[model samples]
Target: MHTSEHSIMVNGIPIQEDDIEYASRSLKAASHPLRLKIMCLLSQHEMTVQDIVDHVGTSQSNVSQHLAIMRDKGLLSSHRVANRVYYCLAESRRALLQACSSLR
Candidate 1:
């Protein structure tokens, strides 16, 4: 069978409709300006909440709020190292970001 005719498997099962639902939500979350800035910052390297707030010229709580929304929508992820929380894009979205950045 052609590659297009074959199904890709995830976690020993085929991908489902719910995955598409999450992608739709993630696309919407990624459309915001501050969220884009956060993506750009993390593209360079993962960063802490304070780093994002400082660079984006927004309040820490505001940054956290945005981060939380992005996290919920499946556009980004966080890793905790001791007291610091580092955030980065979902591994799959990096190419999307590179494409978006190329427009500049």
Candidate 2:
């Protein structure tokens, strides 16, 4: 079979090489154990860094590092309200998370 025939497609459109690279990076960011937990938590609602640390039962510094990684990869978005920074799954990624959840 020709290599072109094996190219990945999404919604009837061929995914660009750069898009594939970006998706791979984003997926990797979410694949870590702690990050995955954080994603699942944020899937329900936005949470403050402290809230995440509490639920995940980890140090604030560790949770903050995971949050930074996911945020940098665009899997998450955050906003500040007064003194608190809240995080939620990026709008574009919500459907992806929902779909993943259904697989279990």
Candidate 3:
């Protein structure tokens, strides 16, 4: 990230439309607690769907549903193994999840 990367204005009113759109999408995807946790877990290393459920203490179906949403939103990526799927962060930013962990 660069200091000028987040510049908030053309003439001081607001930034480019596309920048706002991207930021809005990113923030919205990060809005949920569970989703945030999932991202955090993935940030560390790849894990199976079951591992996420175990660490987050949620039902398999529920976790899968949440993961689906995150995947759709571009926050998570998945790969299929022989009998299971693995997941990881879409990008590498270990520190991004630190703040989320302390919130609760």
lDDT of 2 at 102: 88
Backbone clashes in model 3, listed as residue pairs: none
Model 1: residues with Cα > 4 Å off, grouped in runs: 1-19
| TM-scores of the candidates in the order shown | 0.77, 0.88, 0.71
Worst lDDT run of 10 residues, candidate 3, spans: 92-101
Once superposed on the true structure, which residue ranges of model 3 sit more than 4 Å away at CA? 1-16, 92-104
lDDT, candidate 1, 1-104, per-residue tens: 33634765767787656776776787789899999989988888889999888899989999999999988877788999999999988888887688888895
Provide the lDDT at 22 for model 1: 72
lDDT of each: 0.86, 0.91, 0.78
lDDT of 2 by residue, 1-104 (tens): 43878888888988778888998898888889899899999999999999999999999999999999999999999999999999999998887688778875
- Ranking of all candidate structures by their TM-score, best first: 2, 1, 3
In model 2, what is the error at residue 74, expressed in angstroms?
A: 0.3
Worst window of 10 by summed lDDT in candidate 2: 1-10
Clashes of each: 0, 0, 0
Candidate that beats the other on TM-score, 1 or 3, i.e. the better one: 1
Ordered from best to worst lDDT, the candidate numbers read: 2, 1, 3
